[model samples]
Target: MELAIVGLGRMGGNMVKRLLRDGHRVVAYNRSPEPVREAEAAGAIGAYSLEEVVERLSSPRVVWLMVPAGEPTEQMVERFAALLGSGDILIDGGNSYWKDSVRRAEWLRERGIQFL
Candidate 1:
């Protein structure tokens, strides 16, 4: 499957590497350019921002967030919600409370975006 992974910290970067190793197409992005470049060297398509990430994917894009929880995750969700159309998927791999996750899931679901 093709997907974009935002936030190329330790977990996120490893995820991209593993996915690439498994023959999955991965688009990787980070706040800093270094990790994105590193992931690109590892066979990921490096994207610097959410806009670029969205542009690189085909329809029904899937974006995974491996950043820290709270504001960063929330901001990413909101940004993607604004830019993505129906049928896109967002996977949150951060440490978040169940209640917040539930709230976010419903909010995205209402907009026809799947949350995981």
Candidate 2:
């Protein structure tokens, strides 16, 4: 499977490594360049921005976001909404409140994107 992961923090970074170990193609991104470089060293394709991450994926792009809940996640979702097209998938693997996740799911669905 091919996917893009945004945020290279502890859990996210490990997930990237595990996915690569399992033979998945991973496009990894981080706000700071260090973690992205680290993920690159670990055999994942490093992307500098969310747009570049999207560009690296095929149709129906799958994105796993591992940032913190509140504002950061929301902003990330917003950016995905702008860059991604219909049929794309956005997976929020963060600590977002259930209600917030629910709301985001509905919103993305209305825009023709799948949110998990």
Candidate 3:
């Protein structure tokens, strides 16, 4: 599967590496450019911005978030919801509150984006 990962923290960076090792095409982005460079060196496509990340993927794009919970995750979700089209998938890989996850899922669903 081809996907874009919006956070390149330790866990996110590792996920990108593992996904790439598994033959998945990963588009990597980070708040800081260093991690993106590291991911790029590991054979993942590096994205400097959310727009670049979205543009790098094909239709029915899949975006996974490994950002901090609460505000950061919320911000990224909203941003991606705008960048991604219907039929796209948004995955939250962080340790978020269950209720927040449910709310996010419903909110994204209403916008025709699948949330997980």
TM-score per model over all chains: 0.97, 0.98, 0.97
Model 1 TM: 0.97
The alpha-carbon deviation from the true structure for residue 69 of candidate 1, after best TM-score superposition, in angstroms, is: 0.8
> Which pairs clash inside model 2?
none
* Candidate 2 accuracy as TM-score: 0.98
lDDT of 1 at 74: 90
Clashes of each: 0, 0, 0
The superposed Cα distance between candidate 3 and the true structure at residue 79, in angstroms, equals: 0.8
Candidate ordering by lDDT (highest first): 2, 3, 1
Model 1, runs deviating above 4 Å: none
Q: In terms of TM-score, which candidate is strongest?
A: 2
lDDT of 2 by residue, 20-114 (tens): 99999999999999999999999999999888999999998999999998999999999999999999999999989999999999999999999
Superposition error at 33 for model 3 (Å):
0.6
For lDDT, the strongest prediction is 2
- The digit string of per-residue lDDT tens for model 3 on 2-116 reads 9999899889989999999999999999989999999999999999989999999998999999999999999999999889889999999998999999999999999999999
Error of 1 at 56 (Å): 0.5
